[model samples]
Target: MLITGADLAAPALALLDDYEVVFAGKAPSPDDIVALCRRHDPVAIIVRYGKVGAAAMDAAPSLRVISKHGSGTDTIDKAAAAARGIQVVAAAGANAAAVAEHAMALLLACAKSVAVLNERMHAGHWDKATHKSMELEGRTVGLVGLGAIGLRVARMADAMGMRVLAFDPYAKDVPPFVQRVELDAIWRESDVISLHCPLTADNAGLLSAATLAACKPGVIVVNTARGGLIDEPALLAAIRSGQVAGAGLDSFAEEPMTPAHPFHGEPRITLSPHVAGVTADAYVKMGVGAARNALAVLHG
Candidate 1:
């Protein structure tokens, strides 16, 4: 089996002792990935999502399965893989709890204005009076999607004395502490809103400027899910104008945000480099699951 991205090599090597492994030096382009796959002609290909494309599938006619190192498959061309009779498997649920913890961390940071206040203290400015923070206790937290991560966030928020309101069309029932509401109710009533939905065509740019206009003023927003779910430009405008009090973002529309990014200058925003689910524990679980899935396909 071949691993196409360097980030996955360490984890793959640790968990996949039974397999003969080959590593690509870096994330290869479509053509390079195809050429490499063709040269190896391995029965199973273990790839990091967003690095492999249709060309890789086209290049390896003998490839039976593609094992994803993570959950998201946006980087992979599912249609092409299906057309080629290739099975695609991901380490689903392996990183859910870790990601849920990160989401809650963001929410707490935003509610407390932790980043901005810390910077003020470092600059020798006594801004405690100006940085009056909101308490999570007795506040309403709205969860946009009640999936694995959302459910976990809801339970945590409830335990912290916050009322949990969740909006998930597919979720018929959640914990008794969580009250399922409509999307508009969440927007109108929530003191803090955390997004936990996947990026799909139907929900892309779900949190746009227009949606921000409808939300309660001084609302804290947290998104550890996907970048495309919230419109970046709209979020910037909201933060600047104080329509949104603060935002904690773990992912952005672009990875490794450029130096000129507007959010970099915003004091009301806390940013992380998409490392929410990239924890050591999450990595091991995902790697082991991917290895098991690969072994299953190889033996079958």
Candidate 2:
């Protein structure tokens, strides 16, 4: 069996004892991937969502299954795989809790001004009362998508004494604590806005300048989901104009953000290296799930 992407190597290896595992040195080009597959002719291919492309599929005629290590299949060409009779599967819901916890961490960090306060302390300046910190209690949190991760965030926010309002077109009945509302209401009424939806063509720039303008002034925004969901330029402008009080972002439209990125210099923003779902526990669960899915397809 072949596994692309280094992030999935260790956990996948732990779950599979019978197969001889081969790891690509780096994200191989389409030609390199096809060449490797022609040489190996493995029964199954496991790859990170964004690393594989059409060339790899055209190269490997023997490939039966393409398993994704994570939930998002944005990087994979599903139509091509379907045409080729290839089965695609993902380890969905494996990292929901970890992601939800990380989202809340960002929210709390923004609400309490954790990054700014830490900087002040490091500078040897005692300014406790200079920055006013608000508690999560009595705040209204609007969740963009009430999937597993969003539902978990809603529960946590409720426990913290925050009223939870969620907007998900697919959700038929929300939990008791969460009030299901329209998308416009979520945008206008939320004190803190937490995004938990996937990035799609329809929702790619869901939080653009126009939408950000509709948000309540001084709104604290948290995005642990994909970065393209929020328009970075709009977010930067909102932060500068004081329309957004603060932001917590774990993902970016581009990875390994450039040093010249506008959000880099913004003290009101807390950034993470796309690590919201990278905890040890989540890694193990996802790895095991991927391995099991691959084995089931290969043996069936």
Candidate 3:
């Protein structure tokens, strides 16, 4: 077995005690992965970072399974793996609590201007007389996906006395508090729009300039999902023009964002280093799930 990152959680490592495992170091590039595959010819890969494509698969002819560390498998080339009879699996819902909590935190931060207020206090300025935070008690929150994370978010929002609306065609038997709605309704009536969907070919730019324009003015946007879902340039323009009151983002179209990125100094946009699901507990859960999935395939 080959693990793609620097290390796996100790609990997960314990599960693989009977199997020989190798680490590919931290932040391995595609070429690096291929080189490691050629050297080790691993039977299974527990992917924690970097991508696994046809090149890497071809190098390791014995490769049988590619298990993702977390729910999203967008980084892996599923089509390529399929062609070679290599199975691809994900630790689905392993980080649900962690990610859902992060989404709620982002939504709250954007709604209340928490970051801006903290910065103002540090600068020795007080604008309490002029500042008014938006209250979320009665506002509506629209969720793009109703998966494990989204369902938890909906429950949290509902507890805060907010109306919950979700748009996921595949979701069934959702909580009564969450109303199933169309994307149009999400744009038209939601005061806050949160994305929890996967990044797919058809919905790469789900929230484009046109979609952003259709949203209610002063809408707050929160995305803990893939950044490709929202067009970055269009989002920046919307924020600049005040169409989007504020945004809380945890991911980007490109990972390890460059220092010169446009959102670097933007006050209205709050950014995180794509670590929404990186909590200590979630790490162990994801790691264990990934390890078990790989073992299941290798033993079968």
Top candidate, metric TM-score: 3
Each model's lDDT comes to 0.83, 0.85, 0.95
Q: Model 2, poorest ten-residue lDDT window?
A: 46-55
How does candidate 1 fare on TM-score?
A: 0.92
Cα error of candidate 1 at position 107, Å: 1.2
Name the regions of candidate 1 deviating beyond 4 angstroms: 7-15
- For candidate 3, the TM-score is 0.99
Which scores greater on TM-score, model 2 or model 3? 3
lDDT of 3 by residue, 134-251 (tens): 9999999999999999999999999999999999999988999999999999999999999999999999989989999999999999999999999999999999999999999999
- Residue pairs whose backbone atoms clash in candidate 3: none
| Superior candidate under lDDT, 2 versus 3 | 3
Ranking under lDDT, best-scoring first?
A: 3, 2, 1
